[model samples]
Target: MRPQQVIDGDFTYWLGDMYALLGEKETALRWLRRTDEISNHNYPWFERDKNWNNLRSDSEYQRILADFQRHWERYREEFGDG
Candidate 1:
């Protein structure tokens, strides 16, 4: 069976984090994107998240990080939460 049902946004985010911790880069990113889509989380802590340190030098990971930055910028502009 799947690791968990991912019954909510928090659970989804946790799975993404777990995958990152396991060094499953592709799976981790897939789950992370799912979490972001479900919760629209800004993921401002991504750069500081130790779980993703292994991905820091990865070009794909950097792209994803840029995407997160852009997403947060848009979110802030829309909600004035920056």
Candidate 2:
């Protein structure tokens, strides 16, 4: 039963990335934000993913990137680079 709570993070991330590649900025952003909340995509992963390239100059995408960085900082403070 405990495993029922686990989510397929990769799938969500895929949806976000796919939407981004399709040029659906708003939809991609929404899914990407949800992916971040559920899976916590790392900076390296974000950087190397070309799917999000279309959003590089987008304000909302930048904001999401900032939020992801903040989460990483908090994680580091608590876990010390686990």
Candidate 3:
């Protein structure tokens, strides 16, 4: 059976984490990006998240981090720091 849809912030975060662990950096980033868009509570997790450990040294990962930082800054300005 297909997995049930996840409609919560934490579930999206964990799904991103799972994808990262599975070595799917692009997919993981996509899900994590969605979590960022949907939930302010998930912002702090990215800095020290273990799921992204493997990607730490990758150039693509650095780009993703830069993009995330930009998005986060914009989010803070628009939403008033959550």
The clash count of every prediction, one per candidate, is 0, 0, 0
Predicted structure with the largest lDDT when compared to the true one: 2
- C-alpha local distance difference test of each model: 0.73, 0.77, 0.70
Runs off by more than 4 Å, candidate 1: 1-7
Q: 57 in model 2: Cα distance from truth in Å? A: 0.6
Estimate TM-scores for all models. 0.71, 0.77, 0.58
Model 3, runs deviating above 4 Å: 1-6, 58-82
Model 3, 1-82: lDDT tens digits are 1123455768777887898999998777677666655643444567688778987887866665666677777778999955
Model 2 TM-score relative to the real fold: 0.77
Q: lDDT tens digits, residues 1-82, model 1?
A: 1424454756766777898889888888777666666654656887678888887898877877787788788888898974
Q: Model 1, 52: alpha-carbon shift in Å?
A: 0.6
Residues 1-82, model 2: lDDT tens digits: 1222436657667877988999998878877777677856686677678889889999989988887788778878988987
Clashing pairs in 2: none
Q: Cα RMSDs of all predictions?
A: 2.8, 4.7, 4.0
* Arranged by lDDT, best first: 2, 1, 3
